[model samples]
Target: MITFEGASKHYPDGTVAVADLDLTVETGATTVFVGPSGSGKTTSLRMINRMVEPTGGTIRIDGEDIRRQDPAVLRRSIGYVIQQAGLFPHRTVLDNIATVPLLLGWRRAKARARAAELMELVGLEPAQARRYPHQLSGGQQQRVGVARALAADPPILLMDEPFSAVDPVVRTTLQDELLRLQQELHKTIVFVTHDIDEAVRLGDRIAVFRPGGVLAQYAAPERLLAEPADAFVESFIGYDRGVRRLSFFPARDLSPHEDTVFDDQTRAEDARDIAEGHGSPWVLVVSAERIPLGWVGTDQLSRVPAGVPLGDLDLAPYGHTFNIGTDSLRAALDAAVLSPAGRAVGVDEDGRVVGVVSQDDLGTAIWSVTE
Candidate 1:
């Protein structure tokens, strides 16, 4: 655990970078420090590795004052990743990842072997091991950077806007990759990002910092969205905080209707009658194996020959399916809004259609959970 007891940073000209921060970062969990620029989130992160010296107060890791250890030794024990990867331009990907291990006097072969293992661990191809930083794409370089940070298997990992330089698609992929790694490794992570969405998505707990280096509020993402400390924190979270909060609620409890679902082999006129009886304008068509085919509107079914199977009629795209067992309420809502039939399809682990829920039902679930 890392504890900042009134820890603060003051420049020679008296600029306050951090103001008496007294927060504890729990071990084996990701804690994000997020705020606007010049809010001292980066400075607080740097303080953990002694990269930035605090002019006042004490910072301790596992009860030992950070000042007691030599800066270099302390740094080598902590893994740090920064924006744009910060990779050595001339170094090969494998060599870059092996830097720390080699610096610590591991044999060349052993270091490279460990690097090879980490390269695969971070989703890089074995063939890319010989490539230079300049030869790799932006996403690959970030992966190499992550591999390098984990080269020595440090207990703590510090990331400062590591994904900010990448495009949105790549950024999300990297975020998912980090979450996967964290689940397996359980490292103490101190992540700094100006993006509140990234903080909410990745952080186990987030520390919101205000301008002038003051700590605004620190809490779990769900709580932060549900109840902001003040106007500053609330505005930082944005107007869609209520919607964001739905991510925490599971969709498993949502009741979906299977009455409007029909086998694709069923006659279109028969399916149309059943859907009309259920007061559903659209009906979900599924294959023999229960996999979702698409949606067939009752109007479309009525236009088709009475004896024709639903499989013979043109069906609208189903949009996407939300895993009822694993997905959150947000995902279900998204699926519903995007679906052509205006209903979200819920699927089991095998991608088999379980049932479907309308926007009204989703709204009810959201209300029940939020209330």
Candidate 2:
């Protein structure tokens, strides 16, 4: 655990980078520091590892004052990842990840083996181990940075905007990878980011810092979104916070209807009757193996010959499917909104269609949960 007791960082010119802040980062959990630029989020993160010395108060790790330890040794004991990877351009991926272990006096062979293990742990293939930093993609470089940090097996990890350099798709994949790693490693993580969405997604607790290094609010992601500490936090979270809150609630509670679903070989006339019987304007068509085919409109069904099968007609795209057992309500809502038939398809783990839920039903479920 990390404890900040009235810690403050003041420059020689009287600029306050961090105020007398008091915060506690729990063990084995991700605590995200987030706010606008110059809000001192980065400054606060640097204080944990003594990268930025605090001019006032004190900071402690595991109940021991950080000042009692040598700055160099203290830093070596913590895992730190920064923007754009900050890797050695001249070093191979294996050597980059082996840096910390080698510094700690591990044998070269042992360190290299540990680096190889971390490479797979962070989703990098063994084939990339010999490649230089410039040889890998931006996402791959970040993964190497993560592997390098974890190479020494530090109990605490500090990440300063690590995923900010990548595109949205890669950023999300990296975020998911981090979450997966955290579940297994259980490192006490302090992550810094300006993006509230990223904070909400990865943080077990979020600390919102205001300008002048003031700690505005520190709470769990769900509470932070539901109850902002001030106008600054509310505005920073944006107007879509309600939608964002839906991420916490599970979609498993939602009841998906299978009455409007039909087999691809089902006759158009018969499928139309089933859809209309259920008061649905569209029917979901699935293949013999129960995989989602697409959506067939009642109008289209009527136009086709009565004996024609749903597979014979050009069906509208199903848009996407949400794993009802694992996904959240927000995911279901997104699927429903994008679907051509205005319904979300819920699938099982094997990608087989389980059922479908209309937007109206999803809204009802959301309202029930939020209320």
lDDT of 2 by residue, 1-371 (tens): 99999999999998999999999999999999999998889999999999999999999999999999998899889999999999999999999999999999999999999999999999999999999999999999999999999999999999999999999999999999999999999999999999999999999999999999999999999999889999999999999999999999999999999999899888999989888888899999999988999998998888887699889989899998999999999999999999988999999889999899999999899999888
Stretches of candidate 1 exceeding 4 Å from the true structure: 299-305
lDDT per model vs. reference: 0.95, 0.95
lDDT score at residue 345, model 2, on the 0-100 scale: 99
TM-scores of all predicted structures: 0.95, 0.95
The lDDT of model 2 is 0.95
Angstrom error at residue 93, model 1:
1.9
As for candidate 2, its clashing pairs are: none
lDDT over C-alpha atoms for residue 5 of model 1? 95
